[model samples]
Target: MDYLELAKTVGILTGISGGLALLMSIAQNTIGNYGEKEITINGEKKLIMDGGDTLLAGLIDNEVFLPSACGGKGTCGYCKCKVLSGGGQLLATETGLVTPEEAAEGIRLSCQLKVKEDIQIEIPQEYLDLKQWETVAYRIDDVTPTIKRVFLRLPEGEEINFKPGQYVQILAPEYQGNDEEVYRAYSIASSPSKKDEIELLIGYIPEGIATTYVHQHLKEGDTLNIIGPFGHFFYQDTDKPMIFVGSGTGIAPNLSILRYMQENDIQRPGIFLSAGRKIEDLPMKEEIDAIAADLPNIKMIWSVTGADPGTWDGPTEWVTDGLKKLVDDAKDSEAYLCGSPVTIEQIVDVLTEKGMTEDEIFYDKFQ
Candidate 1:
């Protein structure tokens, strides 16, 4: 082996790598420096911010919270705003998330848009009222064999107002062995009428950061940080028949919607379909069944993809199959679905094929 030659090659490669990193840093400080910029939102509020940060970050820093389930990772597509001016041009990263109609209206993902200059934009008026609540973990219960329901109580003299079926982002701070502090979105399982506290149904993923913290580290009376009711997936006040398909922890939002429906005496025909791998996989059945019994026109259906023949006698089918077989008013009824991305896509396809238009189908995909 030529030791001297090997050392020379290694030295040359290291030097080149170091030089590239230095050049990148220099470029960031020089070409990428955006200096101070003004962000005018809805033509009512103005904020001065650094140009190098994302529009989402700037807004959040200014106490204007927008929902970003992916936390500004260029995914989730929740943090969208109308960039009325000075947003330059749309980038490839936003093409998949923003539709043509949205693009034509200058809508872009706030996380993907950098504040490069004085920017004028428009956002939902409600976002200005968002608050990061400091609450307590009042109780945690096993909603199912694999899922847990976390009950959070607002601090004294405080309350959270939200539409049933909407979700909130909870912060999972850095704990022992895990250094990442991430915020995760969870659907509110409790009724919105319960203003003092809210409930969330969380399924324990083997190593999921937020779920791990919730199932393992979170405890009663523990202080928890929560953001606002930040999702479009909510019960719409309409007379159209409702078809709700939820799987796994996706049942959380539907539970909220159903409870709200019962509380408000919403009488339009409704069906709640709960799907899982087995009977034990189902969550919140007794409560849902009770809610169903209260609603005059509501029916509850159970579908299991993997049925235990010895102990389970329910229909062995997917929720998508149940959605197709049970829904009769797909052409006019509204469908609200929640679950994994693939499951939501399958349900959407089934509903659309059954004569439902895209606008009639709404979903909150657990991404």
Candidate 2:
């Protein structure tokens, strides 16, 4: 090569080295600065965290995990905490999660509130009960064409104790195609009597991260990580006549409560109203029917919105339409409702028209 060409090549090499050094410096300034100011939480002092992260994350990183089902997505509304002082103004994303009274009380969704400034926050004592537990999948079976029942056994001699109707967050394992694990909450189907095994009735949402894992990727003997028996969607242990309404996998928790009542010989007149698009969607009917038959005061009603070609002889319209003629005197009844958001709202309206007070109806609005 000519001397002129060699000089040009040397100049290009020198420039490339300088450019790489500059890029490294910028990265160190941006990504490497995970250390920021010290923040106090509920009077306890903690180390300086990397600036720009949400307060919830910093708490989790410091081993004070918050009760967040949406993983900082700000959708579940379970991560709310009281920012006693120093926290900034609430972000727009947190508006839907907080009520006017709560806002006045200094309540904020920890996941939405960034810890740019050192701040103190208060969390519920019950929230401190939340913990991560590693479990093993003892069994996975297709309960229905659309629903699968997964039973996770806590390690031998281990216990996962929680109240009936509470839900647990199952961590979807990371696979080659997926980069991170995601949590999906499912109501515990197992009775509170069984403390070691956690059961879930999962409805398959096609190609959904957690559902797909439960439906296709998971298997017997595989280990799965899960967290908490959170949520308050169970039976209230009242003597009033009860109305149970569920559709799809929403039926899981209701069934557990019903079985518990039966085993304990708790006699209270009750009606279970289940709705489905087609006959196939109504799986576990025989078991539910048996429970109803064995319990003198328990009644079961099945309604199908979209009829099957040749088999259905039940109500032909929406499930709430069936409630019109059934719950004539809803004033004396306690209603438990679980289903999709739109369906639950419509059913609530019908229940209200039937004289059921808003306070008497307990519902878990699936988001």
Highest-TM-score candidate? 2
| Top lDDT model | 1
- State the lDDT at 290 in candidate 2: 86
Task: Please give each candidate's TM-score.
Answer: 0.86, 0.87
lDDT of 1 at 281: 86
| Superposed model 2: Cα runs more than 4 Å off | 1-24, 27-51, 61-65
After superposing candidate 1 on the true structure, give the runs of residues whose Cα lies further than 4 Å from its correct spot.
1-33
Candidate 2, poorest ten consecutive residues by summed lDDT: 32-41
Predictions in order: lDDT: 0.87, 0.80
Candidate 2 similarity to native, TM-score:
0.87
Return the lDDT, model 2, position 100.
85
RMSD of 2: 3.2
Lowest lDDT 10-residue stretch of candidate 1: 307-316
- How many steric clashes between backbone atoms does each model show? 0, 2
lDDT of 1 by residue, 1-367 (tens): 4999999999999999999999999997889688999999899899998888899888877878888788678879889999999988998999999999999999999999988999999999988888888989988999788799889999888989999989999989889878987778999988999998999998898888888899899999898899998888898888998888887799888889888988988888878788788787888778788888889697888877787668777767788777777776588889999988998888888888888999988899996
